[model samples]
Target: MEPGAHISARDNVVKHDRTDFEVPLMEKDFAELLPRGKMPLANRLPVLNLFNQAVSLGGLKAAGAKLRQDVIGCNETKIVVVDHGTGLPRSCIAF
Candidate 1:
């Protein structure tokens, strides 16, 4: 893991069939991509800082399917998702 080394979702997910404007999923190349099949504007999720923090913590697969979407977005190259999570603890404020 060098400074400029590459970080990718390759180890976590696999490369499968998808279109130009899509990201590859897991296994089989491995996974699924729910309808509403558009990668949300990266800034839309609570994941702004620590996305992985909750994307799957609730087991909501589609909302958290970041790999494939990333594969395509990066042109199947680098898998970059700045998931640093805001160190401040957060919870369901109203719901």
Candidate 2:
């Protein structure tokens, strides 16, 4: 998937804000995006497992867990979630 594509289980489509693009989320597309040999196997395995679990359980929950684990409230990038259809910000997280 392209950067900036919103993965939401609440919606049937993956939405991209910049170009107002919408596409169906399919297993093939996700499988093709998995990390390959260029990445270390040790690093890749956990990520692949997480990705598979996310696919099986649904995206939002898995993403939330990852965000909570990774976000440390440091002076770095900010992560936010917004209402995709309305373009309204819902929550902001800084790290």
Candidate 3:
């Protein structure tokens, strides 16, 4: 669910891009990322939840959504930006 992670659907086509997703449209984005035009609802719901949590957090959510560069824009969702100095584990977290 991160930008540039090389995700593949169970049917097996690779996603076309590696950018953060904008909400409302996020469902659509997830659909597009799938190989068979059939993304599992089970997987999608949690991602939306994550987006909702970010939105509840404030400005960081807005900035994260800004990465979309779309007029539809981001809502209350939070965006986290991190670098090499962040000190968190690289395996379990997203920057």
Model 2 earns a TM-score of 0.19
C-alpha TM-scores of all predictions: 0.21, 0.19, 0.17
Whole-model lDDT values for every prediction: 0.39, 0.50, 0.42
Count of steric clashes across candidates, in order: 10, 0, 7
Model 3 residue 12 lDDT?
33
Model 3: how far is 47 from its true place, Å? 16
lDDT computed for candidate 1: 0.39
Q: What is the lDDT of residue 80 in candidate 1?
A: 45
Over 16-67, each residue of candidate 3 has an lDDT whose tens digit, in order, gives: 5545343444434565667677865653433323456522334555765575
lDDT of 2: 0.50
Number of the predicted model whose lDDT against the real structure is largest? 2
**Candidate 2 lDDT, tens digit per residue, 8-80?**
4344365445445556567554544555625446523333243454232345557766676575333237776
Cand. 1 TM to true fold: 0.21
Query: Looking at model 1, which ten-residue stretch has the lowest summed lDDT?
Result: 86-95
